[model samples]
Target: MALMQSKSKILIAGGGIAGLATALTLHRLGLKSITVLEQANSLRLTGACLTIWDNGWRALDAMGVGDTLRREHTQLQRIDTLSTTSGLTKCIDLQHHEMRLVQRKKLLVALAQALPSNTIRFGLKISAIHQRQDRSSIVTLEDGTQISPKVIIGCDGVNSTVAKWLGFGPPNLAGRSVFQGLGNFPQGHHFQPKTLEIWGNGITAAFGPCNETDVFWYLSRKSLSSDAEISYNSTILQEKARHLAEDLGNKEMVEVIKRSTPNSLSLTSMKYRYLWPFIAGKAQKGNVTVVGDAMHPMTPELGQGGALALEDSVTLGKCLAEVDLEKPAEIEAALKKYVEHRKGRAFEIGVQSSVSGILQSGSWWLPKLIRDKVVFNRLSPKMLHHTGYDCGPLQILS
Candidate 1:
């Protein structure tokens, strides 16, 4: 076995939330030899929306992205439920604990602006990864150039190529798929800036403020069956979505859907997996470990994918502070430490989020009523836990 003397040298794949956060974490810990290889020539975050709860916001602040996110956010006004069938506003929850809504592209841009230039390689695809006895992984880029580092982090997301090369792949479809899109409401956003999950008989609609004039909305139901794939750069999606909302709201919403551009992308929501142990068949476990959706893919019910990645980055960075990375074995040990500390909590969140999706997407006029009346009541103690999660660069349990 051979080794390098650099204090901590890391390689991260994917440029999404988890990979970027991990890079930020490594930097904060005084490790500058971190390299991020993104398949895209440059990160192109679309006009998609995202939530920054106190926990997520805290992660951005820790990474020095607080001001950026604040600038990008549409300060949440309220989250509530309304009946399309009855056309009545039932409950309203303004800000349980100050949440910010920002377009997904803007958030990604802010993260990019915070990182050092050249640390990220645009258009560089990872073709394969070779793990050695020295505990370092040699990442082969599409160009046949192999870059060796002390460890590798997989933040490549659910369709992770690295995970696939390491003998892992996307989990089976979980039975439900989600439809997501943004629309222009000339009549004004009926729901508050806060996220609103409206219940109905056998169906519900969740809408929230994405920006001043736009709202990010998602609807999910049972998938009929596996069929074929379709591209979104056309008007077909918006047409399909109109039927979803015609039963509720008003002509204003329908008008919005009619005008929706072809840029909207749909998500298949049911597939999921837990970050059990990073010891995938041939994976080299050094300072490397997976984070965020790559490690713990799940339904978006909990809305903590980015939040959890931020926590993972911070906690792992802090762990690096105390461990001597000069020894390859130490880095490997730190990865184990990361899994031991995070697996249980992350898995629990994924499971709960998945179940929560099922619970929220339940059928019936009566069952939905009971669930909303009990669960959506903002003043309950459980509601507090639901909205209030810790801001962390949490310590890694060694």
Candidate 2:
């Protein structure tokens, strides 16, 4: 194949939630020449569901997909927590918060559909990244084609190669692993639209309704083995998830795990980066920068992974919209503004999520006490406070 020099003004890696949203945000800003490179042949739609809060919806709405999504997923009304060891149950009302359990596929499709059909190029892998003195970047695809773009945004997720080239360390293992899947009850699930959580004995399992027939569920516990040792086979993952659900003695959750489609089951280690590096280190180098999990991978205990990425897309787009991308210095400055705006917010949420993960998986008595007594009631208010933050609306740049 001949060397294809990309004429696009901006190139985004990973085409996942963060990448798609960023491209959509820029498109909404009347910005053109944005190209998104997705490493997969198509969208990866098998992951567990996302719990998008009001802040996420705000960003989605700004991107013009909020109402489209709200129509598909049920709005969660409350959180019901049960302790397997203590046999205690608590309810946290969420009638006021606009939260929904969204299927990952649906969200990605919505974002992807909103953009121009040619915006995303799938099945192309980046083999190398070279930074230029002018702050532009040359991205080499595995096929040997080279594309030099004025700005490169890395939303490639936790194992982001763009982030690695930017000098970021690997994401730290949270010392815990998660087994998650979607359960389908073709007839009807009949459960109220609420989040049901159960914890104790170093395990946390939660499930919420995506619709009347589809339920998203997950079980998290202290890591039983190293990240590499964890099995990726769907059958093995399903078997382990079912076993854990049985041990928790939740017959309903057990049934959910059993009912899960084999393809939907996944087992992986939870990883996050410390806030120090983001604060003290560089989030951007030249015209290249990272966003979403590439920038701040946090535990799902806070359920902010998807939401935070949505927040990052809007923030980054807004920053770039105000700059004159023709100037390399201006492009770098725009990235710097985005990094500065997001690092502090990302750090705050990252700390809370890490602490929540620790409390959820800690087998020690003191941690258990706090998880049961302090976390349940206080968790909602804290979550609401964070989710209430608005990333502001996008503007159309001339």
Candidate 3:
């Protein structure tokens, strides 16, 4: 109905993991005027859980929340992979790394709590964004209220309107979909602190304990159609998952599915956008840019989606801290530095994830044989180590 002015200098869209983390990182760098807008009525408590590798922990440590997360999670010592088609199995030692499994909501809550009160505004969906010649952005909300902020960060996810407005197209689907659930064992279940995955023809399933009493699990398969519809009814989805697991013939996985509550099941399609053309072309238009899935959506083969988002938050914060935001040219230079530092790493991971997904999910004989004999047993550990990059420190200006 009327234009509203914001005192905040930076406006972040999509108050999910990346957006909230960005706000916290900026606040830690002594920038207090940060606003996070979320379309949801409140924080989303739905998603099952997330596995944070060493690199992700480093980001959390920079934010000062790593210790809090470690207290509630189950540390992983190893990862075991089993191929049903070839009847081969391999185990890779994680070796003193801080890999932990945490509930998604808990992680979000921890990030949100560290920020100043009222930093996030729920139910404020951004409708459009227009960047001025001087590198400031005018953001319009769905309610027709306009606010001009010094910078606009797009952490809105794969279907990001900010990305679209910045000239990045929708992500490409990986031709597969995933069903995930949280298996609750109120009385506690006997699962070792290790990640386990079973690969079958055209299907794969993974399960790992998040804590002493609860486990997080997922099943992925080729989509029935190009545009497969997701079933949201908990009972129906649970039944579908159970049947899929039973068909895979993994008794352990079946038991985990059965233990899960019907309401905790969720189905989502995988999508990603290649980072080369986007980065080589234009990642920042004036003062508006994107991060996390909005900028580099990739398949979850490496489980780095959330981790990379965390890294982006801290890295962007560091870059912005070195510049004078009041000067448009300085702001543009800082964004360029952010893109130069992040694009290569993010693109490498995206391409690796896409290739890994294709190989891991292949039903062909030769690919399966090579994957079982070479990839899992030999190459995977090295790949895991490659992702453990440090995003550097979040520096505060004096």
- After superposition on all C-alphas, the RMSD of every candidate to the true structure, in Å, is 4.5, 1.9, 1.9
Question: After TM-score superposition, what is the CA distance of residue 136 in candidate 2 from its true location, in Å?
Answer: 2.4
lDDT of 2 at 310: 95
TM-score of model number 3: 0.95
Q: Candidate 1, residue 327: CA error in Å? A: 1.6
- The list of candidate 3 runs beyond 4 A from truth reads 1-4, 226-230, 396-398
Measured with C-alpha atoms, the lDDT of residue 168 in candidate 3 is 87
Give the per-residue Cα lDDT of candidate 2 at 240: 84
Q: What is the lDDT of residue 252 in candidate 1?
A: 51
Q: Model 3, poorest ten-residue lDDT window?
A: 223-232
Q: Which of candidates 1 and 3 is the stronger one according to TM-score?
A: 3
Candidate lDDT (C-alpha), each = 0.65, 0.86, 0.84
Query: Which residues of candidate 1, in runs, are more than 4 Å off?
Result: 1-8, 83-96, 165-169, 184-191, 224-228, 231-233, 249-252, 259-261, 267-269, 274-284, 364-381, 384-387, 391-398
Itemize residue pairs with steric clashes in candidate 2.
none
Question: Taking the tens digit of each residue's C-alpha lDDT, what string does model 2 give over 1-398?
Answer: 13235468888998899999999999999888898889889888778788899999999999999999999999998998888766778787887798899999899999999998888888987778997776678889898888888789999999989888988899998889988899999999977889899886999999989988889999998887543454567777888889888988888888888889877777888999876778875789999988899999999988999999999999999988888878889998899889999998999999989998888778899988888778754755455688888998776442
Q: Alpha carbon lDDT of residue 307, candidate 2?
A: 96
What would the per-residue lDDT of candidate 1 be over residues 1-398, giving only the tens digit for each residue? Answer: 12222322677888887888778767765776777778887786754565667777777777777787786557776666665444456444454566776667777777777777777877877788777776577777787777777678888888777767655556657676676767766666565566666655545567666666677776666664531243343355555657776765545556656655446545454678644444332232554567776677777776776677777777667666666767877787777777666666677778778766665666765546646665554433245364455545533221
What lDDT score is found at residue 381 in candidate 2? 49
So what's the TM-score on candidate 2? Answer: 0.95
Positional deviation of residue 172's Cα in model 3 after best superposition, in angstroms: 0.8
Please write out the lDDT profile of model 3 over residues 240-296, one tens digit for every residue. 888989988878778888888766678888899967666684677888888899989
